[model samples]
Target: MQDRTLIFVLLLGLLVCGAVSLTVGSPLPAADLLLAAMGEGDPRHRLILLEIRLPRVLLAVLVGWALGLGGAALQALLRNPLAEPGLIGVSASAGLGAVIALYFGLAGVWALAPAASSLTGAGLATALLLTLTRRGDTLSVILSGIALSSLAVALTSLAMALAPNPYALSEMVLWLMGSLKDRSLHDAATAAPLIACGSLLILTAPRGLRALTLGEDTATTLGIRLPALYLRVVGGTAAMIGGAVTVAGSIGFVGLLVPHLLRPLTGHDPARLLLPSALGGALLVCAADLAVRLLPTPQELMVGVITALIGAPFFLLLLLRRHLREALP
Candidate 1:
């Protein structure tokens, strides 16, 4: 199928999933509440639809879009199919930043503290990555990212270990697991600007990435300005991943899985994959969020957990299939 056709289909799927998300939740006939909310006639319906569901749906769409785009951009820039948005270590740092906020009881008093602090964390982590990767090689990025993740994870664990109270610890743990439930419009608003900036930064690098598939030296020979390309892609990834974790906690797999799924359809060209990957990611997260609401579980499952559950097995299958093909030859 043509890239435009595939993207059109994904957009339609996203719309269908979004409609189901807005209309499928509790008290049944949320479609009525949706209409009432739009009509502005019923305060209670307005509260439920406007306050509860709309923001969650928006954040789901935005976060998914950011992750998917960031993932494809990172993979293309690094010339590594295995690379993901979090490979820059911003997500871990952002989560740690949120934990620090909750530990200090700031989130209790201020609704935006976690988001603010997490964005700061993401910025700091990105700065650290740039400092370490001044030479702008892919290996340096991978290594710096590993070091940053380890340090952030260690600090997060220490904070949990030294939590002043069980409530703080529980909150930290739950937030780390990630979810889109109970998010507010303010959270959605906060994430949108940064996600936009990051996405725009990433979108600029696809031509470079396409050139890169020829090899870094060849790309450089083509006047791709390797250092500037790295700067743009990394900075953009940090912003998007940071923004995503701020609102959704730590949802995973949308970045890694969506691109791989869409790659073959896009003929595996980095430039060709971006739009479809972004659309597919949004559709995946929106549908997953809706599924969590509909499932007959004790509690609404964390969407992050749901993605991890699906993605880990998918990764294993990917490896096994690759291995089997090699063995067959």
Candidate 2:
């Protein structure tokens, strides 16, 4: 898998999946769909394409891109094979904030309240993570993140336990499950800037991360400032994760799944893995969302649920393979 070929395939998949996404629930013909997409067909069909499907597709891509890039950055930064977006507390904290918004009826006052609250939580977690691990090594950073994640989960459970009503509890639980459904272009726009900025920060990581493969001491001798590198990677990851959670709730596995799948293609180069992972994430989410829409269930299946179903098994298999390999040697 040459990088060029891999990129081309990913891009083509994204385009095909995106087009398929817009037509998943449509009864219209392909020709009519094209007309509607171009603003020259039935108004109702056009509305569905523009207002309903378009936004959903955009959000799926954006969230996937953020998750994949952030995940790769975190894995490279920590030099850990198991690293994912949730390892940093962003998922739990963002989830807790969204739960708070819905649990207390804050969402009633403003439609975007949940998104705002989620971002705030992510920011706070990032701040706290940096503060706790400021002068510490990667181990300290990982431990601090785990601590924050634990606290956030505990608080979220408490909130659910004391919910004013079962309905409130249900709502909180659903949002935390993560989905790209019912999103709007506004949501995509809201998430784009943070994701873009964070991606920019992480894209600069290849040289440093490559050097880091030689150990931190060797990296330092090679002129890599470990502290600055850590800050850039962690801060960028937080921002991207925050942006993703703002719209998609707590979708997981894109970050965890994409990079590892592409590692062989990149020959284990952490830097080379980022772009492919991001593209692969987008393709997975788009295809998954399309699959969810096509399912025969009475209600549309949630994208988050589908990914979890896929990712959990893959994760277990990955662990088994890793342990087996170690045992073999």
**Most lDDT-accurate candidate:** 2
TM-score of each: 0.96, 0.96
lDDT score for candidate 2 against the true structure: 0.88
lDDT by residue (190-230, candidate 1, tens digit) is: 89999999888888777898998998899899989888888
C-alpha local distance difference test of each model? 0.88, 0.88
Please report, as a residue range, the 10-residue window in candidate 2 with the lowest summed lDDT.
129-138
How good is model 2 by TM-score? 0.96
Candidate 2 residue 310 C-alpha distance from true site, Å: 0.9
Q: Could you tell me the lDDT of residue 48 within candidate 1?
A: 76
Candidate no. 1 TM-score: 0.96
The clash count for each model shown is: 0, 0
Q: How far is candidate 1 from the true structure (C-alpha RMSD, Å)?
A: 1.5
